[model samples]
Target: MPQPSKLHTRFVRQLLPLLVLAFVLSAASTTWFTHRSQLAQAQVQRSQTLVTLGAALVKPLWDCDGTTIQAVVQAMTDQPNVRSVLVQDQCNATTWQAGTQAQGPDLHTLTIPLLYYASTGRSYSVGALTITFTGVSVRTSLTHNVGLQLVVFATMLAAVLTGAAWVFRRIIGRPLHRLREAMRAHQELTPIPAHWAEELAEITATYNTQVQELRRQARHDPLTGLGNRTLLEEHLQRAIRRAERTRALGHVLLLDLDRFKPVNDTYGHAAGDAVLKTVAQRLLSCVRDTDTVARLGGDEFVVLTPDAPVEGSIQALAQRLRNAIEQPIDWNGRALQVRASIGVAQLLRDGTTSAALLASADAAMYAHKQQDR
Candidate 1:
């Protein structure tokens, strides 16, 4: 199956980072809430412990010394992880006589009502004991909502940032780089890059295959599969361009079959077409594939040669074209002979347009036709 597009791939690439960040944030939020709940538990635990300690000294409240009270306070504060502990007596005079810890604005306080009960009825006693929790151990896991929120926000932010970079580099960057290198290699007409995506490679393969067909069509005739006028023009254009740019030698020959009209009139249009096909084959056999042989329609044709010596070479090509066409050919096993009046033209630097060059060759061919007559 073909892979998804680059756009979809990039989206998937970006989406993975977000998913990881979301997972991390969810875990972090769970952790933070768990910690918050633990803090609440700690609050309840300390308050209950203070109530027990305060209940012990109900009758001896009036006789309690600051030193004795401070001892209880010290003991509660020294309990493992407890930061500070304070206790208050119910009596209006003896309240708050525990713990040496100083109070901060961030303290948490819990109050418990004290009652004395007889078998007959319950009686209200000294009021209440207030336990204040503001100490070094708590460390303000949450302060005014902002501190806890900031910490959580920072964690999620870091995870997102790091995830974005990692996902982009791994998923998007590497593949995109490979794609770019493949495009460069294709532009240079070099071998396809190994790292090229399979889908892109398939597309390139299809495109190059179609291009090869188009190139073949451009250089070969549609009906007879021989070189056509367009092929001749292309080579002629290239030769002219090279002669101008690189000072190269170039020549073009125009050949018109002689006595071709009598064959067409005596045989038929089909026979005429066969004769043309036969002539094209002979012309093809006369020169290298590098040399272009083109049919300018009817009995007219042109041959183009580049890098050939100017003086003798152009005349020789003209003579060869004439001889190739004059040779006898078998059409459906019927033998026939044809002749061509050949004209030769040499191209100079910045010389002539294809039309003008062919016109010159045509005029020369007409001159030869008259001489042959």
Candidate 2:
């Protein structure tokens, strides 16, 4: 029962894990490279320090100065990270040794040959000096560096997630909420505001088109392309409400085609359809743009006039409608004449409710038809 539309669920289940994995892998790789580089630098520094020490001890071992050799070894051990140092003589005998030996895998050793200049002016190896470093300081520095890197990585990950959430709310969450509201209210779909992502914009555009077509199909007649009975009732109710608010009178006219059956029977259904279409156009031409003309059903139509003037105005509009319907329509090279019986009713005068007003108008139309017969 998980809703994919929920932003928090999507972020946690999908995006959060992906981002975390990527950050972990990147941080791990960076830490590994840093560790190797730090170890290499420590080794190079240790070797350089040992070579310098061995050179200084060469003169001491050659002169057999035990005090100087011991002093030098002690001083070398005193330097940071130096674990142990040993100096030997030409006979390969240990001359001086200082500091305790490191016993862990982190220990590193380097040995350098001690050379002396003989009286003959030729340099020869007199002894060897061995040095050992525990690498404790190096490991500490590496750990500190890794801890700093983790802090920076965490900060960057937080920033990326924050930006992503804002983008999701703007592009996905907000638009979806608006769409849901429009659906619940049964209103026309409003076009989504401009978005940074093109795919999202396209999706919004497609949704707008679909909703418009759905509304069109729901409210319009398929045959004459006019508003159907349902649309007429909705418009009538709205007009009644508006008239009540403005204290303006309104009118309703129901029209029934007088000879519509004869046209269908004598000329076939095709001619009947053409006649209906023609009558729809004529009705549209007779009224103002503010008025609503609707086809209730077969050969039956209704017109709603909001803010209508006096009774004289209503009668004049009805006469115009009858005249429009009586006009001859040319159908496939044949002149066909049709008449309509119209009933007029005034808003607030005839009735208040839509059903009551419609019944009154319908009765008036039937009375007019009987008189014509």
Candidate 3:
């Protein structure tokens, strides 16, 4: 089984940025917020020392003595973060005593907690103070700000990701899909047109040009630039179809040179090649444009006629081929007489395959060579 593809790319392309943003923003806000909270706690701790001082002087507040209250309040002022303390009666909410720093006596009626005596039932009454302090407002502000910021950030992130996905589909996905379709079309077609997209158009055009070149190569003889085997096969198949439809005869003439090998051995392979080329040119001149004469190999060639073959037509074609090849080929102040043997085969469709026809024609040509020798 193939391994499953991972969505790791989804994580990198989409989720990573959102997560990093959230982490960075959260860390920064939480750091400042935690600092402010700690600072407020520290301030609260400092003020808490005064609560201890007021509680210690409870005996004095309970009608015990002034000296005790004064001593306690004075001691609190000396403590590290303590400012002042005022013991007040809970029932009347009146200050019993104020510290040295608690100048002007009443301190506009300070409301620190005080423990007092009850005469009738012999019970105690305690007072509570409304104290003013710092750091509370700072901590509250931070809490509100951080909560609101996080909510806004989360909403904005969702919107951004949604927009990014939409753009990716529209801009990247659609264009890439179109380009792929164009490539597939080119692959399926014979003559791949210049369907290369704007970006890859030149590349596709080059491929199309290559395809055309390949077709030309398939149809032409490499040695003489004449029709090759593929073209010959096409011709024979078409001629068969034409004969079946119209009741006309078709002929394919196969030709091979007589004593051509001796010339090649005496003069060299280069001279032999030139002689074949010359033979091709002569055959081309002898036949009409509609007729095709092509070199099958070194000393072998074929001519295809789509129409009816007369009784003497085959011999006439052979004579032309022999005369054409016998012409002089001059090289190095020496004139060479080129020569070739010819054989003819007439085609009858008769449920015959292309390969069968070519093979029979080749056998007929070899027989002709035997007769000539």
Which candidate ranks first by TM-score, i.e. highest?
2
Candidate 1 contains a number of clashing pairs equal to: 0
After the best TM-score superposition of candidate 2, give how far the Cα of residue 217 lies from its true spot, in angstroms. Answer: 4.2
Better of 1 and 3 by TM-score: 3
- Cα error, residue 107 of model 1, in Å, equals 21
**Candidate 2 segments whose C-alpha is farther than 4 A from its true place:** 2-5, 65-88, 91-109, 118-124, 132-145, 170-172, 188-217, 234-250, 265-269, 306-320, 332-337
Q: Write the per-residue lDDT of candidate 3 for residues 178-253, one digit (tens) a residue.
A: 5467556644233333433455445446656766787788888887888888888888888878877887767777
lDDT-superior candidate, 1 or 2: 2
- Return the TM-score for candidate 3, rounded to 2 decimals: 0.52
lDDT of 2 by residue, 215-295 (tens): 788889899989998898898899889878886778889999988899999999999999999999999998888889899
Residue pairs with backbone atoms closer than 3 Å in model 2 (clashes): none
Candidate 1 lDDT by residue in tens digits, 1-373: 9876776467667766776677667656655675577677877777777678667545444454556555565565655445454455555455454454455656566666656555689665644556666532323433344455567667866776588767766555665566566556543223545665676566656656766787788778765677777787778888788777877677778888888898888887788888888888888777775677787777887777776844466677677677777888777777777898887777773247787778777778889889988
- Colliding pairs, model 1: none
Clashes of each: 0, 0, 5
lDDT agreement with native, every candidate: 0.68, 0.83, 0.66
Better of 2 and 3 by TM-score: 2
Task: Report the error of model 2 at residue 259, Å.
Answer: 3.4
